[model samples]
Target chain A: MKVLVIGAAGMVGRKLVAALLAAGQINDKAISSLTLADVVEPSGLGIDIAHTVIATDLSEEGAAASLIAERPDMIFHLAAIVSGEAEADFEKGYRINLDGTRALLESIRLASQSEPYCPRLVFTSSIAVFGEPLPAVIGDEFQQTPLTSYGTQKAICELLLSDYSRRGFVDGVGIRLPTIAVRPGKPNKAASGFFSGIIREPLAGLEAVLPVADTVRHWFASPRAAVGFLLHGAAMDTAQLGSQRNLSMPGLAVTVGEQIAALERVAGPKAVALIRREPDAVIADMVAGWPKAFEAKRARSMGFVGDASFDEIIEIHIADELSGKVAL
Target chain B: MKVLVIGAAGMVGRKLVAALLAAGQINDKAISSLTLADVVEPSGLGIDIAHTVIATDLSEEGAAASLIAERPDMIFHLAAIVSGEAEADFEKGYRINLDGTRALLESIRLASQSEPYCPRLVFTSSIAVFGEPLPAVIGDEFQQTPLTSYGTQKAICELLLSDYSRRGFVDGVGIRLPTIAVRPGKPNKAASGFFSGIIREPLAGLEAVLPVADTVRHWFASPRAAVGFLLHGAAMDTAQLGSQRNLSMPGLAVTVGEQIAALERVAGPKAVALIRREPDAVIADMVAGWPKAFEAKRARSMGFVGDASFDEIIEIHIADELSGKVAL
Candidate 1:
């Protein structure tokens, strides 16, 4: 299938692109082409197929129509303003996250009215669609009372995806991913970044700060699992989804202490020792209300699997980034 | 306590306005005025307060700002495109329900930020916010997975209300009202109208078509009960709401067969004989998937209540609408 990846420059997008290319499942002859778009051109997003890169800001009026002009069979919509940015910049957040998605969905609906085959849209949502005062383990049936602007935007998009899919405008699947841990990149502006930075930086033999207490528990899946979710969503039968189109993806729940222990086992005491605990009162208050775990029975039944342990996640990072070589 | 009611010409709004005037619960000296606005002037509303009437189309850009210029202490937002109209006309629905509500909220937010006192916003949401294939009985905790465009708009407004409330811009409460049964008026465009028309029309010795089977079930409250829900939402302490600001109001759930039986018992067998069982397959299919009952424990604990039974609901219609005159 010819595929288009929106937000192709982001961490999960990069992994999905690499996975798709490495597998050769979508061939140059059979799949034919790929189109990648983002606010920034997806530099270092190297793929040898007939690829077009569009650095279009989608919130502007008419950007959506232009993007959907050459409709691909599958569209991976991974674009969103991160949680902290969304909470801070109200108008920009809603403009990009809510309006942009609606514009794209509208364009897709318009195009598919004439075209025989509408594209399959795999939307990456987040666990943040849930809010405070959650059941100890959040189930698929939990009502979306998103506590943050970022979560609200994602939940709204999920609603739109279901409605559009029910209307037969397009086949869509929404995967509400847990926070991707050990995110392989430089520290970003996301409030959740500390969850990843603590591990990723230490693995790279750099000092990392833990902003919350060691006992602070949270849910996580590796970036590799997030990519797997996208592919799995693309391959699933739409008929099974019916009207309820979103699924809360499966992941492991562990505390900061557990994450440190896992890192020590995998990368030696020196790497773990590089981590310093200096709790920021602001971040501690924020993380205090975050969901600790999920009872993702729906996702499990639908065949979406995730990392069994944090060690496996670290190993995946090492094998991919360090070429299966590690220095302790 | 100055009050403004949008869609003041609509059924629930008219009732609520009447209730507010009749009760006169606000300190007479403190409450100087009330403002009622709609696309058409709200004539014969029978309110004694020093009130202003505005016939303005809220979809216009400056309408909300002008409406809020008086700076009412409380705003009751009841304006929306009903389900059928919204489903048929997507753009109009989005403009009126989504954009209109956003404009009003934005105006209120601006007013609050510029000055000291933010108005308390009492928004009338709907059970349409919950979609099917739902659980047999939905609870207050049920996630909003709206099956219709109107519902999607309500859900979006709920999110905005929550975000605005969280930021201390405005105190907002969204009440998800059940289908108001025994609506004393000519049949309107709402698909759920038949639920009320079947009983109300038949009680008046008029033949009414039952569009769905007797086995079909739904949740409902009397129009009087709806007024109570709105008033309680307005008067109750919102600080008790915590982060889950919106609530599903408690109502009775009954099957159509049971409703007819209740009508027959209250108004004699002749009223039941006046019911025509001409099932419209389209409406039947639509009604079949709707939530028949709700576990509104949160609202119940918070003191919102409804008629105990369909029989009681029928009596309410007679006592309230028919002015204590029951006809067999």
Candidate 2:
């Protein structure tokens, strides 16, 4: 089966592609065609399979139509503006996140008119869809009242997913992913980057600043669990989803103190020693508004699993990232 | 105060205008203007107030901008395509519902940028925003999984309302109205028309068909109660609403058997004879998907009230419609 991965150069996108390749679920003997598209040309990941990497911007008028012409059986939609960037530039956020998604859906609709083929659309949503004044554990039935523009965009896309799926133009499933902890590589502009940087930088023997206090709690799922959610979402029976297509994925709820303790346990006290506590008033206020934990019963019932503890998350990061890399 | 009614020629629109006039809310002595806009010219309401009736199609470009240029202090957005019509015509539905609402909001935004005036926008949402397989009583926290195109449009509007309100662009409140029963007119193209028809026709000494079975339940509020909800919503302390601007108004949940019993009690057994039981499979299936009851705790807490029972609904209809024409 042919597969198309949009935003294929991003962190999770790269991991997802690697996981798919390692599984060898599509074809064993002959290499299956894989199309990876991103704004920047993906570089140096040892992708030796029959894959085509296209460097293209999807925001242009005809770009989406061109992308849909390939007619891949499965489409993983992971492209979006990060939370900080979206908040800073409102117009760009709406254009890239909202308009881009709409253009893609419309292109799929127009393409299907030629010959009917409803592909499995896997959309990566975020817990940012939930806003402030939240319950301790947000249920599946909780109303979507997003506080940020990024969250608003995701919530809107969730609605569109349901509508499009109901129309039968595409079999869409939106997974509201938790904040993926222990994110590898250099830190970007995400406001929530500190959640990962606290551990990742320390593991690299570099001092990492903790913006918020150790008391602040937030939900987390390891990158491994995130990839697992995507795979399970792709393999699951859509018949059970019915009209409600968007789901809040399962994850672990841990406070910052708990996270540090886990880091100390997995990476030794020397590694944890690289962490420095510095409270950022702006980030602390923002983090305070986010939901502490979510009741992802629906996702749990659908076979999504997450890290039992923050230590497990750190261990996954160790196995995946620091196994053969320049270790301290 | 100046008032602008977007769909002033519609049934509820006309009633709302009349009620406003009777209450003397529109200051007639000063520069207070009442702008009535519709696809067709309004006629024969016999009001001596300062009013202008304009026949303009809102779907046309620059229509919303021109409408907002007047800068009325109160905007009643009652314009929308009916459920069946929206389901039948996809393009028209999206064009009128989604595009029209956005156009109007953009126009308001443009107007506000030049001046510092934000109008009190009361948008009329519907119970169609909720989908099937609902709990026994759907609360304010129930996720919007719209089963129809019309509901999707309304849900989108609700999202926009919340975001715009949070941004302080407009003081907006979306009131999710329950199905109005005992409509005092001929049947419309809506699938739920039979709900009103069963009561209206029988009360008017004419035979009406009951499409669904007696056990079929539906959530309802009288047209008067709907108007009350709108009035209360318009004047309520929006500061209490915070980020969640839209609210589901309270209504009575009554089954068809209960309605018949109420009819029997009010107009005796003879009037109940006008209701001919004709089981329509299509309507029955449609009815099955609708919400039976709503737990409108938010609206109730905000001081919005409705008819307690179907008997009260029938009595109010009689007192409002046939007070002098057909004495009980």
Candidate 3:
């Protein structure tokens, strides 16, 4: 089996690559070759696998076609501009997020027409698809009324994924992942970056800004669990999905207080105290509209798993990102 | 105020044009000019309004841009291939329905860049946006999982409309019309054409085929009511719509038996006897997945009205299409 990972330079993508290498195979088939693609060449793996890293911008015309010409058995599409960036740069967002995704799908469709090709396509969507006026627990059948440009792009891609899959262009599964907690990297510009920073920073003996109150609740999953979702989605029985190919993945819904308690439990009060309370109304207002929780009954029933608590999430980060060790 | 009707040659479009002519004004402003555009030039309405009819395909490049350059104050986009046609001709369906609508929106957005140009964009969406595994009554916030290619296109367009509106690109309103019953013209190849055919043919003293069972329930509105919806959508205060611009319009939900009863009540048993029972498994299966009813609480609260009952629908057909007379 061959695998193609788009956005392979990103944090999740790098972790997913590591996970794939660790397993050595998917669905009992040895991954003979791997193609890691992004706008910049991904590096630092240094693994003994037949892999090629390519710097490619999919938004450019003919780029997607050229990439799909290789015809990997499974394609994990995780390429996208972050939410804050997309909202700030509208044209760039639509060009990269919407047109780029469509170009990829179209390229896949064209490729299938030339030869018998139906690859397992796993797309990473986001909970940003759900916006304000949300229910207490967003159900499996909640409507997607994204309030942000980034969310709109994701929602549109979800629609296309379902349509293309239904039309037999590709065997697609779109998983709307929860915000990755304890994201193993420096703080990014994403409004939800604080979700990870508040944990990652404190664990490294650094102060992290807390923009919102302790009551501010949100959904979360560890990078390891997100990788698990992609793998399971690729290997699972898509026949069980019916026509609705996109699903909101299950995650631990926790408030800031719960997260802090989990931090205290995992790394003691010293780590918890490192979180500096700095109320930023702009970020708070933005976070307020986000999805708090979801009754991801469909994905849960389909066997997609997530971390049970923030403590477990932190543990996964330590194991995966910190080599099972955290700085005191 | 100048008004542009994109699909002015079609059934509802023609009625909408007539309605506009009858009203002479919209939102207390006299319609100074009317531009009617379609694949075929619309004619025979020799009203004393400054109007121009053009045969144009919106899916063609530069067509929408040129039209938007004219800067019509109100743009009613009612053009689309019907459900059956779209399902059969996949590429053409997406080209005209999805790409064409997007082209128009993009053109409007581009036009806005030159100057402050936010026109009232009233788009005609459909009940096809909702598919099977449906609730007894689809509410204001139901997930759009369209089964057919046509439904998929409409659903995608709705998302784009909402996104564009939210971004302040255009003042847009998308009204999802119920199946227009007692259609004036001859039956087309649409799967839902039978809904109008049964009542329309019998009222004309001709035998009409009923493909689906009498128990099969579906939503309905008159051509007049559909015209009313477009006009109302064009003139209504969109600020009240907030971010969710698309809405399922209010309609009468009745079984085919109730429809027949209403037909009999309006035009006597002689007319009802003209209906032929033809069990078409193909159309029956197609009809099975259609929307039966809708809560449409949002649209109702927003003051978009529909016929009270099937009887009112029949009355509308007689009054609007049959010159207030039904063959008895």
lDDT tens digits by residue: candidate 3, B111-202: 98889999999999999888878998999888998998888899889888988999899899999999888888887777788899999999
Candidate 3, residues A64-155, lDDT tens digits: the string is 99889899999999999988889898889989999999899999989999888999899999998888789989998889999998998999
Among all windows of 10 consecutive residues in model 3 chain A, the one with the lowest summed lDDT is A317-326
Error of 1 at A82 (Å): 0.8
Q: Write down the worst ten-residue block by lDDT for model 1 chain A.
A: A23-32
Candidate 3 stretches with Cα past 4 Å from truth are none
Ranking by TM-score: 3, 1, 2
What is the C-alpha lDDT profile of model 2 across A154-223, one tens digit per residue?
8888888888888888899999999999899998767789999988998888889899999999999999
Per-residue lDDT, model 3, residue A229, is: 98
Report the C-alpha lDDT of model 1 over B124-188, residue by residue, as the tens digit: 89999888879889977778888888888888888888887887778899999999998997877
Q: What is the C-alpha lDDT of each candidate?
A: 0.86, 0.85, 0.91
lDDT of 1 at A133: 85
lDDT of 1 by residue, A1-328 (tens): 6788899999888888888777656424355678888999997867887788989877988988888888888889999889988989988888999999989999999997786657899999999989888887988788888888888889888988988887778899999999998787798877788888887888777898888999989999988899999988988877888788999999999999999999889988999888988879998998888889998898888889999899998898888777876655
